[model samples]
Target: MLEELYRQVQCPVLAQLEIGVTPCALVFLDAEASGSPNLRCGDAFSYVAQAVTLNRSLLNAGLPQLTIATNAIDLVDDYLSRLDAEIRPAVFPLRPSLDLAKETRFYGAHFKLDLLEQMALTLPANRLLLLLDTDVIAQHGLDPDLLRRCHASGVGAFDISDQEFSAYGSTRVIDDLELVAGRPLRNPRWFGGECLIVSAEFVGQLVPVARACFGRYRAVIPDLNHQGDEAFISAALNILSERGQAIIDIGAYRMVGRHWSGSTHRDLRWFRGCALLHLPGCKALLGRQANRRTFSSARLWRRLVLKHELNRLVWSLRLHVQSRRRDKAIADSPEAPSQTW
Candidate 1:
């Protein structure tokens, strides 16, 4: 059998791999109230473990400079304190915990936006801030070229999944933005908030725009669910787009709500050339694993063992062939697909 991958999720520390240099800060907000369901599930340990895992991944990805925002620092304090004394200072608070529902016009979305807005005030216009969910696990640190492309585009999200308006006729999102901006702006694309890269130039307006749109959306929608943050981000990007600003979609191989949903051979999405793995809408480590128990008990998974084994052999052979072909091409020419990483 092939050896398991060099997955950051399993081991927090990685031998630093050489990636082209790109200076940027990776920020993660892991603030969860003590009463949160994740805490109730006794999953705090895993949450802290994932945070360390992600931190180590970033360090190896040529991005050792990390800024972490969390209110539950006590939960991860042990892990954080174990790092070099000099490194502990990077962990800070996500402040002004107002009626988050009132401040950012949404619950989870605006709290992050508010914090980001404040961070942008001091961040230089030349640098880029890659704001990500604390739950995101990176097998690869990040492709420097991917980040450069995202930075060049001004603003970028992990993927663009939402079309103009989803089923709910969620005009409230746009309406709130219009009320704040005092003008109409078009929201064309839906973004995945699991991860976003913002250039200093656009941060100033993006945060305020998302805040304004969400704040008044409460009165307009009246019964809005504190669900996806992408809706708020989409509004802000729409306004930016109207004024000739652009946001790029840094597509990934696949995204799944339940982390283990695509863990088998039937889910071809897992085998693609994915850049990262994201559990965007997840609120807890236990939640990402919820599918594991069910998947393990599935009749198909049990009955199709032989078929799955054959699929694995075929997939492995294809990868081997591709690698050999690329290696041969590299021997013949300086520029080849081998540099894709």
Candidate 2:
């Protein structure tokens, strides 16, 4: 079943690149189509800007980078064309799986699993693969020894089991996954989808099980109750751990801070110490940081609290209206013509 997903990947540069020789970072971006109601930004270009900024940070950290993108390939190419060859990653084109897109709640969340399955098939065994969401920004180079230790442990993920948000309540994830599995799980955990550190060997084991678990979940769970990739993968990890797989909680090591500036859970002090930060609520700030070529944690907070709140409120209202208008248009539209011509 996973083999079908490989059709979306076009890795023209994979042959030229060396994979297992050193650590590599895989950043995934799926640009929402033009004129769509994008929650992250006003348009797709802002998302591309964030991705470019992220790729640069990974390159600066002395790691080879690979970017998997859909729809924004032209924009990414244009952006990388202006930069020096040293900073540009081998950007692979991944057409979004339309079926999975409709099946999942989030637009592109499950694409990571597809890419992970692809990586498992392609990359050398036990090679370190740091999968990062486009929203993540690196403040400093990651520690090599620390990364190796995490890699040695089979998998490393930021534990979000205790963190609860309205959209995705982490507390209920285990129970929900258990319901999907049709049995109770042992030592199950919930992870934020922002950053995941995995070995290619581990991925080979993980993706199959994750996909299977997700298949069961999608079949049994209601569309409204469906959680995205993180929960499904966590369920698979928990199952594997019970069978003697090592799943390390990288949150304890402060590898990455999942920071949303607009939320009450925002912790700048803790975020400062982490090498990577996932700023989901600050896409506009990410665009600004990308364009300015400077990143300041202090500036992020100031802008979010002082300026962006009102703008965000306005944007939200505008988006809501646009969505309603689109829905009404679809609902009122005439049926398609017959093919009997």
Candidate 3:
């Protein structure tokens, strides 16, 4: 199954810009596969704007940047060009496999995992790769020694062990995944997909396991609510760790998820000290920040925490009303399923 998946998903990189003088590099993924669901927060320009904001933040932090884009090469290239050539991210244009387009559940999130697998195979093994989401921003520069230490240890990712962020994982999800993998997880903790730091060698080892798990997950899709890459990748890491592989929880020191939406409102006091902030549910703020010549984090916070919540309330209410109307319409339809059980 793994070999077949590799053959189907693997494709040649059309072109790549070279990164200079950095053993560690950062790559942000913002791509939509051909014939795949368009699940970006906003239209094409919005998310690309977010990535532009993130790229500038990374360059400010002294990290060389790269972008792995599929199907939207011209758009990403234009945005990255806004940066000066010396620090602009090297854009690698990849063609997404048809298998990636078939996924309806995740809307091409898993496709990036396949893209990362290819990156692991193509890029130099000695250099470390930081796979960042477009929604995240770097708060501070990382020390050269710290980057070396993380790369030496193993894969770096955010650990969401606290029960507060139940959206990331649960006992039920782990139990189901363990049944699929046919192994019990020793450290059953959830890792967010927002920011992942990995070496090419480790990714080479991890992708096969994740691919196998995903292949098996197809049989139980109806039984599972969460089928994204985060769950499967977390399971794969746990399985590898049980086999003596090192998996570092960089959430403690490197990055933190700022949950300023939904029921999870994390304290912002700790965010100031973190090196990176994964600002999910705040794409509008990100786009606004990108247009500015200078950004103020304080204003970003006020708009995100206060104004965003009000906007979310209105958004949720509208969704609820739309859902209720849809339910009524379904009930009225002749083809609606009989409610009798």
lDDT of 3 by residue, 32-86 (tens): 4222122354355566667667776777766566464555677667776775565
TM-score computed on alpha carbons, candidate 3? 0.71
Q: Which whole-number lDDT from 0 to 100 does residue 331 have in model 1?
A: 79
RMSD of each: 16.4, 13.9, 11.6
- Give TM per candidate: 0.58, 0.70, 0.71
Model 2 stretches astray by more than 4 angstroms: 1-42, 60-66, 69-75, 82-87, 95-98, 101-103, 121-126, 165-171, 221-226, 262-266, 293-341
The most accurate candidate by TM-score is 3
lDDT of 1 at 289: 33
Query: Among all windows of ten consecutive residues in candidate 3, which has the lowest summed lDDT?
Result: 12-21
Worst 10 residues of 1 by lDDT: 17-26
Q: How far is candidate 2 from the true structure (C-alpha RMSD, Å)?
A: 13.9
What does the lDDT come to for candidate 2? 0.63
Candidate 2, residues 1-341, lDDT tens digits: the string is: 45534532543333223333233233334444222222444555566666666766666555456464444567668876876665455666655442454534554566677767665555565466677766677766775545656666668888777774344564466577676555687665767878888877788788778878777766665732545667677778778878898777777788888865434454446777888877776666666666555545556556645644555566567767978987778767787343465
Q: Provide the global lDDT of candidate 1 against the true structure.
A: 0.49
Where model 1 places Cα greater than 4 Å from the true spot, the runs are 1-46, 72-79, 82-89, 101-109, 122-125, 162-187, 225-228, 252-260, 263-272, 280-341
